[model samples]
Target: MKVLIITGGNIDDDFASSFLKKNHYDEIIAVDGGLAFADRSDLSITYLVGDFDTIDRTILEKYIHRPDICVHQFIPEKDYTDTDIAVKLALSLIKNHHSEENEEKVIHILGGTGSRLDHVLANLQMLKNILDEDVRGIIIDRNNIIEMIRGERVLKREEMTGTYVSLIPVTMELTGITLSGFKYPLENASSHFGESLMVSNELLEEEGRIFIKEGMAWMIISKD
Candidate 1:
């Protein structure tokens, strides 16, 4: 099942609307300010959640009484972000809607990658929370699509969504990391934290592969 979560951020409305229209989502969530963005995207929110702090009062009032939307309100003193709670809801839905063997539940987060670095980072870290439950989390923006891959990942050049594929180290060190069909190929390469040698890579052939024996890697696909 594909669950789409929208969070408070300075998102590109046109890009977001286009993305929402193109993809089919099984579940849609609005996290506070995302309620306004969801309204702009012409999408009906299945679950509206958050502390209701950052969203517009008028927008909140408009949807607060809607019968179609399931609203989950929280206090401002809560520890978890709206996106975090939304992820939890999506996971719960997966458990009820899918079979026990359904481990491929994907959560695509939109409108959460904005100028606020702290919030953006927090949203990205939410992927770890999702992964812990054996689910996939992807953060999407106008210029970038980000995901964390701990094991091996295979890709086809033509299947890529952006102009560049960058791998960032999230752990202390990653060993036995091999890159094939890349402009700058590596064989059994090892990297420590804060390494830039693996960034901005392009595929040389039709197929590409990233083999990681240990540690975590965050892959960022970005356009020029």
Candidate 2:
């Protein structure tokens, strides 16, 4: 199942509407202040998680007693952030309902980035954990779609979300990096920390290939 987590971050209404209409989601989750956006958008939520600290009380009242929605409330001074809790819940739900025969599970996070640099970085770290569980996790905002990958992946032209595709090393070092069907191709290249070797690349063909032999990197598909 593909689950979507909406966190308490800056989300543009026009962007969110456009994004929602373009993609299909199996489950929707609202985290704390995200509940306000979910309510405003009239999205059918499967799970509501947060401490109700930043969310509007009127919006919280609307879904608290809904039988179809599962609410997971936490204390304001809890150890984990509301977004973290929501991600864990998504993973749990995916595990409980997933089957060997089912297609790959994916978690798409919206409202995950904003002015707060610390929160944005923390949310980015969650993608690595999701990768460890054999699931795909992506963080999406108005300008970018971020994902972490370790092995190899293909980027289809039609599925590209933005005009620019950039790769930033998540690990201290990355080796055996190869790129094909891109404007800037690389063969068995190596990149280290504080390097901008692979940034702002574009696909030259119908599809682009990226293979990383060691270490992880963030594939950011972005727009101006």
Candidate 3:
């Protein structure tokens, strides 16, 4: 089943509301202050996960009695962030509800990026932990969709929605990288940290692909 988790970040109300309306997922989970967005947008939130530190007690109290909502509150001193907890919960649910024959589970995180650089970086790094799992997670912001990658895979470019596709090496080096259907194609190119080797690359056709033979990379697809 498809799950969408909306967190509390810098989100444009109109855009977030519209996107939430368009995507009809199996479950919708709201994290902390994200509950306020869902309340304002009139969206039905299935689950609420977070520390409840940033949320207004009065507003949160209203939902406490709701039967459809499952609240998981954590201590502020915990090591993992609210988003991290939400991700783990989603993965657990997916594992319990679905079997091996089913399709791969998808977990989309909204409100993942904003002013807090530490939180943003932590969310980005969290993707790496789930890369090898059956669950697929992405951090979606107003302008970009970020995901972690390991081993070999193909990245297809979408038209208009995202103008630029870039790859940042998370480790020391990413080997045997091949780029196809892109303006600046690369075959077995070695990418390293502190390098602008893979930035502003555009799709030459309808789609573009990136193949990583080894190591890990963070793929950032952003709007112009």
Models, CA RMSD each = 1.7, 1.2, 1.8
Q: Quick one: best lDDT, which candidate? A: 2
RMSD of 3: 1.8
lDDT of 1 by residue, 13-131 (tens): 87877777778888899999988888766787789999999898988998888999999999999888888899899989876784546446888998778878998888877787787
Clashing residue pairs, candidate 3?
Answer: none
Clash counts for all predictions: 0, 0, 0
User: Which rank order by TM-score, best down to worst?
Assistant: 2, 1, 3
Each model's lDDT comes to: 0.86, 0.92, 0.82
Candidate 1, residue 200: Cα displacement in angstroms equals 0.4
Number of residue pairs clashing in candidate 3, backbone atoms closer than 3 angstroms, sequence gap of 3 or more or interchain: 0
**Candidate 1 structure lDDT:** 0.86
Greater-lDDT candidate between 1 and 2: 2
Candidate scoring better on TM-score of 1 and 2: 2
Which is superior by lDDT, 1 or 3?
A: 1
- The Cα error of candidate 2 at residue 11, in Å, is 0.9
**Model 3 misplaced regions, further than 4 Å:** 99-102, 152-160
Sort by lDDT, best first: 2, 1, 3
Supply candidate 3's per-residue lDDT for 44.
83
Candidate 1 structure, TM-score to reference? 0.93
